[model samples]
Target chain A: MKQENRQRLAGAAAGLVNGLFGGGGGTVLLPVLTRELEGRHAFAVCVAAMLPMCAVSAAAGMWNAPPDLWQAAPCLAGGLLGGILGGLTFGRVPVGLLRKAAGAFMVYGGVRYLL
Target chain B: MKEAILTFLCALVAGTLSAWGVGGGTLLLLALTLLLDVEQRQAQTLNLLFFLPAAGAALFFHRRNGELDTAAVRRTAIPGALAALVGAGAAMLLDVDLLRRPFGLFLLYAGGTLLFSRGKGFSNQRGEEAPPTKKTQ
Candidate 1:
């Protein structure tokens, strides 16, 4: 497939996931983007693309959310700091180790959810 | 107070992962739903909202490092945004359990792939193979 077409499909898929799941666009975007662009560029593209997608999805869901959702403000604040930290350390950290840790966490999450 | 602190810590990890472009939302969702005992739909809503700031911060860092691809961002953003609208609508109509099971399965698939995959797919700024791609399946 053409690069343009692949990108479109990937974008659409990522958007859909972001909308449905609230913010997992990167999970869908990473593989497709990796195949379409260079590795680092692909990661950048995923990050760039997710910002808008998350904004739109959050807006769409805002009216439906319960008031209790505000309780998450602390989490959101922490997440902001984490994002800054992650961004600053992006190239400095061992990508492989981070990936492994992320993978382990995902697995733990999955199993926890399943049972 | 303790719960608030825990929430902050979880969000911090999620935010970092989001900045790293590794799907922090998934982790956030898991923490909220499984650990904190939030409802699935509500957890998802918070995850989306939490993403805004996290993504913004990450974008700032990525741009500073010259990692962003302007052309690619332009091409993907609109289409992705539109599709996200459709997805959000669907999620609203779907049952809570229906969303939870698939999300769990997806996490498993994605996590397993990341753990075992060789570090040959992605390249760093130096153009050397850096690590495997971190996308969820």
Candidate 2:
């Protein structure tokens, strides 16, 4: 398959997983992005790519069963603050360590969800 | 107020990790269900919603840092978005509980790859790969 085609395919799969699973598209997109982009750039770029995917997923989820925004307000507020901090930290961190940490988080998620 | 405070803190942690381009939504879902006793589907929905502004904020910083790849975004966003609709449809059809184990396994596989892949180390957008930590030390 052509490279662009593979990327689009992965993008579709990433979106589907993000939509179906309600996030975690990064885990899927990162591997693909890393091949084309540089290290830290790959991680940052994954977020860029996943943005619209998450939006579509969020909208679809709401359509099926609208959530109370009131319930989400606090989480959003905190997330906004944290996003700023994490973004600031993104460029400074070592990619190798970041990679390992992401892996560890996935491992943790695996265990948490499995139980 | 107490419940709200707890929820905010949990999201703060998740959001921070997420902005780093990792698994913040997973953390948020886990915290909401395990710590706050939220129902699974609701937590999942909340997680999707939570990602938007958080992602926007992170994107701004990444753009400023010159870390974002606009070309890459342009290439992937549309397909990803369309597929998201399909994914959401799938989520709606299945029981939320059933997705957990599969999602869990997926995470483990991805994580293990990340942990051990020995892919290229971190580099700046200028294409300067950072020297190893030991070398720097």
Candidate 3:
């Protein structure tokens, strides 16, 4: 298949996932690209890719009632920090361990919310 | 040939994760590093770029529904943007493994805060009760 076709297919797939999941596709995409494409291209692709997914999820969350600005602001601030720090911290960190740690955090958060 | 198929599959899965509210960036980064052998920095950068449209769409939808606080978004935009730059700069300065430990700690802190902190809507404001949110008649 052509690259454009592949990308379009990928985008559509991403849109659907975003529609269903809310905000967690990059977790899945980056690895695939990294494994397949490898190197800087994979990294660039991952960043470029999440733009749409995050935009969609945020829009959906705010679709009916906008969240309190004060509340959202801090989170957004964190996100910005996450983006920059995440980018910079990359390569130097032991990502596998980081992944396990992050996963543990998520599990904890999820359990708390569920309970 | 294999790469093309894998990329498509990855995109599809990532999209689903994002839709569910898990924030695809982190997971994608994990996959890149563990499964694909992609470097961390490159993964992070790409993840951010991917988030653009997803975040934008969410913001637009919220705006249309009157959920977006334009003033608030505007207020934080400059500061947040600057912070992002600072974060990026900081990333460049530190050893990523070292940074990861602290970052992980921060996440734990944030999770703890969310789990333990009472709703700040009223308690933090002295003895005053929070104003009841009136439904727009």
The order by descending lDDT is: 1, 2, 3
- Misplaced by over 4 Å in model 2 are A95-102, B117-119, B122-137
DockQ of each: 0.59, 0.55, 0.04
Chain B TM-score of predicted candidate 2 relative to the true chain B: 0.78
- Candidate 2 or 3, higher DockQ? 2
Reference-based lDDT, residue A76, model 1: 75
B1-137, model 3: which lDDT tens digit per residue?
Answer: 45434433444344333322234444444454445554444444444444553344433333343433233223223333333333444455556565444434433443343234332221112222223332111
**Candidate 1 pairs with clashing backbones:** none
Q: TM-score of the candidate numbered 3? A: 0.43
DockQ of 3: 0.04
lDDT values, one for every candidate: 0.76, 0.76, 0.39
lDDT of 3 by residue, A12-67 (tens): 44434333333333333433333333223333444455454445444443442244
> Which regions of candidate 3 fall more than 4 Å away from where they truly are?
A1-115, B1-13, B16-20, B107-137
Per-residue lDDT value at B128 in model 3: 26
Cα RMSD, model 1? 3.7
